[model samples]
Target: MKPPFPTLIATAAVLTVAVTVAALAQAPDPPQRSAGSPPPAHAFPAPTNLKVLPKNLTGEQVHEIMEKWKIALGTHCNTCHAEDKKNPAPDGRPQLNYADDTKAEKSTARLMYKMVEDINGNYVSMVENSGVPVTCGTCHRGHITPEPFVAPAGNYQNNGPPPAKDGEAPKLPR
Candidate 1:
């Protein structure tokens, strides 16, 4: 005789669920970051009543701090976007292409310039009849402030589809 109707229906339902879960478990892992993604931007915590570099410093001391900001602050010249081969902006903001029709409506460029100037004055000291310089340890001393490192949240950058061939589009799962 045939199995009871209720028993057969329950078995089929259970099997279906088990198969679906198993299939899902076997799915591929998500993509990871590509080889050469740039690091996040450099930023500082807004210091309350912050001071500037020491006044009347020599050229060397003045320059030393600027260089230190790069490594200690977790920013390279290309922090914002593409960098020029020779000159690079310490803060990472890209320079606007004069020929381009589009320009950033906001005055971020001015803000960054002011920020760089303000930072330069903070701990700078003057030397006797000479220039001033800053060391990497000047601000970093080991810790990165305002520009602390935060781990990436997800793999957004590397998840795009492979290059299209013969103008055909890729299909997604149903």
Candidate 2:
């Protein structure tokens, strides 16, 4: 006698799950770092170029900050840092020269950083109960260039021009 349809379906599902679990279990373990060994590929070396950023920052700290900026601007290291043709990685990829300021974007980044610092220190601090500090991501929103803001149509309280004078016809938006 043939097995019921539900029994066959259940058996196939169980077999599929078993095969998946076995494959996952057989997968190789990720490489581990050893004591006294060099840092991994993702790790940054000692920072040589200290301009806008504080000189006291360690390589790892700078790396973390740069990673945040990278995500904020939706760009990579190559956007500001230049490629070092002379020193290529073991895999033959050109390494970034973090100190190189040949690119205009790097200077612009420094200026923007200063602006943010000033705004946060001088302006944001003055606001009552304002905990949020401005960041590159605030304006950039994951784009190299910030998108222009378009005001919503029609006059609304607080958003549009002040309430029209009692006698004057309601002024239309220019």
Itemize residue pairs with steric clashes in candidate 2.
none
**Candidate 1: what lDDT?**
0.46
State the lDDT at 157 in candidate 2.
Answer: 47
lDDT of each: 0.46, 0.83
RMSD for all candidates, in order, please.
Answer: 30.2, 13.9
Instruction: Report model 1's TM-score to 2 decimal places.
Output: 0.20
Q: What are the per-residue Cα lDDT tens digits for candidate 2 across 58-153? A: 777888899999999999999999998899988998888888889999999999999999999999989999899999999999999999986666
- Candidate 2: clashing residue pairs, number: 0
Q: Candidate 2, which ten residues in sequence have the lowest lDDT sum?
A: 28-37
Each candidate's clash count = 23, 0
Candidate 1 structure quality by residue, lDDT tens digits, 1-174: 976998999999999889766655664321222323343243222223212445554344444554555566565533322434354356775442312222242133334445655555553433444345444445444444444544465643455544468868864323
